[model samples]
Target: MKKYKDFVCVGFAFALSTVSCEAKNDAKIHVSQLGYTPNSDKKAMVVPDGKVDSFYLCDAASGKICYRGKLSPKKYWDLSGEDLQWADFSSYDKSGEYYLSVGGKKSYNFTISSKAYDDLTLWAHKTFYLWRCGIDCTEEFSNFHGQSYAHKAGHPDVNVIVHPSAESAGRKAGSTVKSPGGWYDAGDYGKYTVNSAIALESMLMSAEAFPSFYKNFDMEIPESTNNTVDVLDEAMYNLEWMLTLIDTVDGCVAHKVTTKRFVPMVLPAETNVQRYMIGKSTATNYGFAAIMAKASRLYKNNPDYPDFSEKAMRYAKRAYEWAEKNPGIIFHNPDSIGTGSYTARFPEQFRFWADVELYLATKDKKYIDLTAIDTFQYDVPTWQLPASFALMSLIVGVENNMVDGDLKKKTELHFDKLANLLYDRMEKDPGRFPLFKFEWGSNGGLANAGTILLLQYKKTGDKKYLKAAQDITTYMIGRNATGYCFVTGFGQKSPMFIHDRRSTGDGIAVPVPGLLAGGPTLDAIRDCDTYVYNYDHPKSEYPTREYPARAYNDEICSYSTNEVAINWSAPFLMLLAGINENSK
Candidate 1:
């Protein structure tokens, strides 16, 4: 038998199995394989083949019963079509390794400690460093991410062409521009401004929300010696690249820097394709302005980048001015281009975000006046639904007294309403997450939902909010309907074959660690139909998903279900960092 840390790897013949091999005794029992903090809401979901009522939490080594609890009443969840029972053990606060057993079946081992999420937080954050373009992921990183993870630099955008769609009077088609150093937007090698906006917001917000957690949390990237936290350094690498995408002549920002189409699955060094500065739109400017405004505030007065604050503020104002001039001009790829478009239906969200961020950064009443708060429906943050990011900033601004009484009251009420909605969803759902639709990139939604719960915890010091937030962490790690970790290389049954170009093309057995896969999409069959079956079981033998939560494929071709992305990763890192901070 092979061991994956605490989990035991077993054979391939389990019923309803997605992966060929998983944790030995985890067939009916699911948990956060990385375990929980002593005070966290430690609950395990059980889907037994037979009826079981009681559960025992026992010491892993000694086999002594530490806690005995009656299982919660069986609840049928339509998301997975399973009757799940929860083994509530939140009252047991001992710090030690333990496992749960019900009837005759047992779960994988887990630990109860203050540092349960430390490794996860570190691994998740370092993924940003590994995805960086224009710089070699040097062999020195092999010590941290293993030998197979290091690779030569790729996509030096020094000679990038300005596509006809993005052509300005001064910079026409085929004219060269120098734009470099940003993380790949997703499974593909593109770098998109709209997507990077939310991604960087999540990362910077992590640093802003929990300074003590990241103060000494070194990721050991190349910029570790810069006297700033490594998260800021990693974020700055992408920030610098984004700054280059702006048109100095007109102040409009390009939508993305991408090949005409997605390149084949190959390592970055192996690909030789012409990268172009794609079209620009109002969305790009607002997104860019929002990120720059937020960055200006975060990096202000720092010794390492003394002038960056002012520079960012100036560029932000420029972008905002251009956006005001060219309102509602949506971007579309030209006839020749076929990369990810990232088009938004509701562009006003971007304007709202820039207004809220600019207001928070400058404490100007004019910026706040620009936001249409009465009609604007606050949503969970995604690249498209970005008002949530601005809402979070407003909450922070109000708490810090950045605004006066009237605005603060409005911001507080907005947060309370949104947080209450999430709390209501948590109370009703068996999974304890605010997940309804299993859309593409659903994991990112879960992470953002978890952030809202955690922020509410910060606001009210409510243990219920903390418990609900921890449940989301557990669900992502393992305790979900899929019975997989959903991250690339963490749990015993995590994704080994993510639909990432570098990971699939590198000849490495393991995909890059810390990447959160686009988990459990409803479009799995349509996405994976043409791809090769790389798993041990035949396609026909795989379990039939009657519900959304069971819809996932670990094959490399399952882009909708198994691909990784920056927007997904950023919020997850924030969620983990926030959870770790509360644990400490």
Candidate 2:
């Protein structure tokens, strides 16, 4: 079997002649990428086309062999479309620069260090500060990619045109409301209730899971100097904005606060378009309820803002009542609106999550009775569908002995099944990538899957689960197809031209640091013109050679492939946090 693995040069490559070969065989080996963590499970791909059964890891400094390893065959993958093998270097635990050699071929230089993901983790958390809406990004705050007067002057959000999908007796075309202060949804400037719920909850969960790690952590945002913890302060900023979205009269939350169409690529302050409270739905209300309930618990009796918890509880109760009365209401973007729809086909999950949060916060038996855990799906968390968020919250509740006996058993059983399934899939995978499906923001799925595996490892004390989780992170920095580091401003060959409006329009040399590009998507929905090869074919048609995993282009126009999103960046941040804390 002749196996071919994808390999791209990272800036420069070492001279092949520099590595002296002891074996006389003509076969050679290849590696997926050029980096690995010292404490994580480390492995390099061995191209199956070669007859090299074994290879030696040599120290880069002295050219002395550190450890020799036999190659193990892995299952064939559709991405490579060929059988490949992996050289397990998990047993090698020394921190140094090293390379693998087979016959005359030498793999790229890789570093094994404890601080591998430290800088990236810090930058990932700071990305939220950059994404903060309705704030002036001063030079001191923004550093290199500074832009002043950025969305600082927000409107009163009165006299807005309410879409027909959201039209009610009280909310007419010329309705008056107040909504401000939330992070932009994605590459575009939009604040959505559903998306904000996921982003905020994920960060809060990160804080909960790793309290000691985040205790002294400073995001360097405007609120960093405050007496409150920086993560809580940041979440509070969005929580405040979310609170204003809910109508005090009916407890209905607007779907989004956005313009009729996406503004041109320019500085935030340059664009002066009127933003509107677009629509309201049960999904939005339920999401708002869940987030506020969670916030109520996080902010209760805190050093800063002692009254925030009571206010949040009141808002949460109001939203929950609204959801109870107006269940199953879905919001479709009105015909006139050209912004993101953010439509939720299934609002039941949102309701369940809300019930769980409210139950945990208030310890009210009524909130617990409304939950339907049997229908909940335990998978990696995402913004669009957030059953996993509720599941994770319940798991944490059980660990803290906050959940009752019945609920705790159900949560544990669900987690055990999910962990077993994930472990089995990883064990059978040829590439060892957690997610089998490659879609928009697939890297986020990879990271979230790693988070789940890490949780399982923490619970079961199984080294295999921990190793699998580490493998996923290793794949992100540099590994597998495409060979580009999905994150900007790190690694030798990372995304230079991401589909970000600020980075594209800003006159800066590089895009904002710590932004994770939506990795390869099988469906490149937007910006088809940039992919000239698919001109004659259908809009959805891509070349046969363009493997799903390899179908990525680091161009400004490839929005489907190269776009940076908050939902995608959130899990990556959590994964980095897990790795950082666990490595310690």
Candidate 3:
């Protein structure tokens, strides 16, 4: 397994020359890589350090100024810790290739078209195949990363070994169990149940929210040839693996499957390392139940997969029962394990999600009564807290007249409050972005926030909520402090060295498309020591000021800033789906 210490020397080697002068100049004016929809409000970010007082939109080919505008009044951004201004181009509705010019510097070329995000939506869905595990990623399917025939030597995981890092009650070393097939969790090779559950829920919700959009959409995965909805087919590839985590004998589920240490950045086929099933916990079991219950409904009417719904419901019921019996169990990674902890201190949200989903699936009053629906707070769903999954399910139930009137009214009130709060916050923010806290995976947080706002737009028919959601997507592409598209292969100046093991080692010039990087971390808590020792050349090499949002670096060595994860990409897909649906 790889250690953090191994990268110290490598970090030092690249630190001095990583941030180029060109990037510094480009940071002055940041515009979206995908540009703006023809009729939507368009905006660009102008850093405080820049001297530009006004901006102009010029044709990319002709270099003729089409429109000019003054910068918005400066407002302090809590996340970026900087006073930033915006250049609004909302009135420019002509469809053309254009660039933003502030002072004498020209921003990256972008497009203003009706179908701005059409290709992006397809590419985002294809990203899942790139992150797939348990199979070879052939050149035919992968444009970058070439071909990696991985895990050929590995067995079916029919008898999972319990490593010392995962010792627990009813689980001993060399214990035989069946657990197999799932997508790799992140830049690493670990397969985490908590993260997988959230990603699956995102896909499921995307399907539920925009059935017509994803119904005939082609993901171009191996299962696309099958007579089934491509979105559900892609989700099933991961769901099948998640099913293996369930210990049918006892109804508990393993938290994750990983080696004892972080593996080196190598092709999956070359690693050939032994993997183990880690500790079992109520959180994992309940999350599994919630996702499976949702899956049961999604696949219930599918003619291609006849038994999928029944099997999912049976497993969900069993897992929910087990969680009820062991409600407080939390899996803390043993000291020996050096992978992601994915620990959840509170499992109530997980329980609530499972109950609501099960009720939706079975229409059982018992499940609804157990949900305690009114007490639960609605928020954007994350791996740690998944109350949004329950909220989403309930919203769907109310729409279908499956939920009680009193509970439906309460849920609607919560949605109204959240929607208004998010819209008001976005209106007040200098950049019109809806986030206040900039942490690891902050890009994902922004995307999830957009999902929440879009949900409210559906419930309330508010265009402001929809516009706020679109603003979050714009912020991600290039309208932020870093001035680079956080996704790997989209923008003119996008991430090239994201902290994905395969992308780093695959000998590919470009990383996979649509993989969202964990954006700026304000405190620099995880990678500060390495940065200080290696990149703090004369204290001026790195960005001098400690701005909350400006803390991002696009280097591969900066894992805190540029690591790509499934959880991040999932919500991004949701945001994309929302945009696509609304655009049409």
* Number of the predicted model whose lDDT against the real structure is largest: 1
Q: Give a tens-digit lDDT track for model 3, residues 40-72.
A: 768888765556576667767656666667877
Model 3 segments more than 4 A misplaced: 1-25, 48-53, 144-159, 164-172, 526-545
In terms of TM-score, the best-performing candidate is 1
TM-score of each: 0.93, 0.87, 0.89
On residues 326-371, what C-alpha lDDT tens digit does candidate 2 reach at each position?
Answer: 9888888888898888888778888888989999998887876524
Q: What is the lDDT of residue 370 in candidate 2?
A: 26
Q: In model 2, what lDDT does residue 438 have?
A: 78
Better of 2 and 3 by TM-score: 3
Q: Write the per-residue lDDT of candidate 1 for residues 440-537, one digit (tens) a residue.
A: 89899999989888888888899788888899899998888888888877777899878888887778788888899988867656665565533432
Write the candidate numbers in order of decreasing lDDT.
1, 3, 2
Ranking by TM-score: 1, 3, 2
Which stretch of 10 consecutive residues in model 3 shows the poorest summed lDDT?
1-10
Clash pairs, model 1 backbone? none
